[model samples]
Target: MVIESLWFLIVGALMILMAIGRKFVERLPMTGAMVYLVVGFLLGPACAGLLTIDLQCDVALLRTLTEAGLIVSLFAIGMYLRIDLSNPLWRLTLRLAGPAMLITIGALFVAAYWGLGLAAGPALLLASVLAPTDPVLANELRVEEAGDDEPLRFALSSEGGLNDGAASPMVYIALALCGVHTLGSSNPWTFALAIAWGLASAAIIGWALGTGIVVLVTKLRTHYDHALGLEGFLALGLVALAYGATLIVDGYAFIAVFIAGVALRRQEMKATGEKPPNEVLESVERGQREEAAKDPELAHAYIAENMMGFSVEMERFVELGLMVIVGSVVSAHWQELLHWSVIWPVLFLFFVARPLGSSLSLVGSSMDRHQRALSGWLGLRGVSAFYYLLFSLEKAGSATVANLLPVIVAAIVLSVFLHGSSATILLDRYLSKR
Candidate 1:
């Protein structure tokens, strides 16, 4: 059809413009996520005339794209993180991942229950789905390099990175509740197994597979220096291996991918076969720097960089595709905002739920007031939350969640504007003064 060709042209052109102008956007107040979102908004037909998605037909494909986006983003986030187990910052990350995430979940449950007047199943589902910040959208809020130790950025990124899997248990819980409410069929094992064995399997598989690859790559490059270039794509293999193995057992693949990334990154740090950088600097000859270039440790860094580049490119491609579709969906449902219940949830999610939950998690931490506030303020939700919604809808196999979908979409639209617009200006200004 003529419309399909025009649609492809517009989408392709938009991606091209984003590619060329990436530098410009990076330096400005808006982000690449924002560009895709805004363009989607433009392309979205308010009257549902131009591009109405047939959810029944396209759901599988759409879900795959979003899942891919999350997969790539999670790996990238894990790769960039410096996994110092001994560091207090790691303590902070754990605290945030555990207590902070729970606090957000509980708080949002209240908002959904009282604010939306939903029963247990949908209320808990909304809370669980929306509680965690999305890594795909929170990339700008995260660290890009290995050595950078900015506290808020690290905390937010780690929280986003871990919480996707962290929230999976709750997703199972919510689904169980949905079963109880809808089918009057109660099974405690679903939630119990998902929380317990699922997490354990992800950790085990991810650690085993990821560390295995890193060790193999290190051995190969150490024995055969001429083969360094061959290891560039090893991270992809690690991701696929760990994720596939985890999912095969019904373990959390999202968590597995992230853990694999961390495992591999940790191997890189330790694989140097030399002194730590600080120690190396003291006794090293300035002229020997060239000699050190061939070291296996340096090779690890190079391999990690190439792997990160591949993941980032993949993440961006999936993100652009999904957001364009999201923009169209939001555009078609723009009038859904006229409902008071919809507006209520949007306001609560951004202003009340995220900040309150985030603050609750930071209760005893040494972070000062300003740092604490930024941590609360920067819970940017995107892609994965929508995926959760679609997943719940499909799993329930009914229209009970139909009404809730629009409200969640409305909240996401608000998030796209609220978080996207503020991420750059607010973060830049705040970090600049620091």
Candidate 2:
């Protein structure tokens, strides 16, 4: 009961701060995620001792909420992506998403073996879990607005969206090899079947549900007299449905959410005559016109108009939840930081695995020197890595291995706060100039 009340208070405070200080918070280097982590640490058992969260006891609830947040985040990402998949940028995204991820994982595995001195199983597991970049955090960097349609920006956005799902398979494989039971039975065939079933189920459900939502929205526009507010509700409902369906099938909810997002975007485009919603298009046009309307003496309209504020809000909520959870989990395992077994592997993942994966992924791609360099440098580790790490650790239940969990979580918190905070400034100074 004390814990529940603390949870409520923490969440309430976070919401208030986010509402009142969003722009100010995001402007600071690593400010958004940093604030969340700080709050978590303060309220956590290690500091003020006002909150104690146990995922082992609260696993069912935590999983459900985290999965829901992830789905909603992915859906918003899909809704905002206005890129044409047939473009040259799409090819660049493939290179970045595919090879870069592989290289990072391979390098991390080697680092784990040599630098961390971990056995092959655990090393590979750590590398795979941390492989994907978090789009929600990455967007905090310098990038075009959702409707900008700039090839480079679109490539970055789409790569972030698609790569997380792509990395899911590697994570599952690593877990199986590491003897983690979260993916289902221990048999290799059972694991393979579970993956295949999960992927197929998510795709099928996402397509059917996404198509239906698009059709229903179209009919509402054609037949109704009242303003439906379809976009807001549709976005929320689609995420809920996608998450619910994946849970029903015991599949990876993150993969299901991403597939749902991709399907929803594709279906919405098909329904709207192969174009994005005119609302977003008109908003972009208005932004451009207003920009032109400004004189040297007149105040410039804040570029905030160009962004999807609603999506940004949802992402902030997810960030809050993730930070609190990280704090609770890490505080419980604070002793791990002193161990070489833990410290060395965590260092290798950040310094070795991620960089190697990103470089490999960009090879043979059409990106210029600056773009490739930025891509490699901007591989910010955030919520997704933390989420997978905790999930895998819970399944493993090895105190020796579990002791290493906090070190990785600490690394992610470090990356998200430091990397996310500095992204905009760095991008403006480097990539934008290029």
Candidate 3:
């Protein structure tokens, strides 16, 4: 009873503090994720002993929490990117999420196999898990608002959004190598086919549901004047629907959720005929509220904006809860982290693999050298990696989890400290220079 009470007290106090001090915190080099992680560490047995988590025993609960966090975050990431699909800016996303991602995976796989002496399956699994930049923790480096498609931020935001889903195929492939039970047959050719189907079908499912739902809602609100003012509920419902629908066909649910957000926002753009200026967006949204159901464009803008707002709120909450959980998990696994095998790969990932791969990938892009360097530096890994780790635990079993947990935890902590502290300061200077 006392422990439960302490949980409430700690959470309530932290929320109040974070709410009141958000702007002040934003000015510091540290992130909200860092603060939450510290608090969670303090709550762990190594400190105040108020919290404990047995990774092996609590795999299901952790998996559910992390999955929920990713679902909300990926949807928000898609909604936040208000750029048109044909904008040359998309090339940047592809560069980072595609070849750059693959290169990073390959680099890590080589390191894990040769340097760390892991078997082929485990090496690939580790590489695949850590491949994508995090959507949740790297919010400071993302596009601040819809329609603010600044090249660096847009590229980072879109890359984070797409790669989380994109990494799903590689993870499944690695699992197949590990002899894990997965969606289809376990052979290489069959796995390749499954990957192709999952990616293609998930994209279709997300697009159809995302685009279709908004059109239906807009029509109902327009002609019948029903189903209005529930944008938050609509956002949650859409993510759930897209996820379930994708999973039903054995497709990648993360991709479906992300593309759903992008499609929803695209529909809004179609309704408005362009990406409205921020001032225009605010005016239209205000007009929408004052005179409900009067303007179709206004409804579209309001729905998209409100849904994006709700998803962002959910994203922050997820970051706080998950960071704390990550901190606690680190507490439980500190010994494993001290091993030489864990430390070197993290250093290699940050110093050599990511930088080399991303920089090489961006060689022909529009970004200047400085921007490319920062982009490579800021591939923050967080909730997405944890989600995959927990997922592997459930599917691939406890032995895999034991082998992978320490390095994953080390990498996430290193990122939270390294990227979290540097992002705001570096971004401020980068923006000031620009």
Q: Please give the lDDT score for candidate 1.
A: 0.75
Candidate-wise lDDT, in order: 0.75, 0.63, 0.88
Q: lDDT tens digits, residues 301-412, model 1?
A: 6566567778877787877877777877777777787788888876777777677767777778867778888887788778988888777777774465776777778767
RMSD for all candidates, in order, please. Answer: 4.1, 6.5, 1.6
Model 1 regions lying over 4 Å from their true place: 1-5, 45-50, 180-190, 224-233, 273-297
TM-score of each candidate structure, all chains considered together:
0.89, 0.81, 0.97
Tens digits of per-residue lDDT for model 2, 1-434:
98788778868878887789988876676566677777777777888777678766675667556656666667666656645556577676677678878888788778776776777777777777777777766666424544456545666676666677767777767666666555655777877788788777776777677656555554544455222333455567766787688779876556566666656555544434443354434444544544322321111111112223455567777877777767666666666656666666656655666656656666676766666666666676766676666566566655434644666776676677657766677766764575
Pairs in steric clash, model 1 = none
Q: What local lDDT does model 2 show for residue 272?
A: 40
User: Candidate 1 — worst ten consecutive residues by lDDT sum?
Assistant: 273-282
Candidate 2 RMSD to the real structure? 6.5
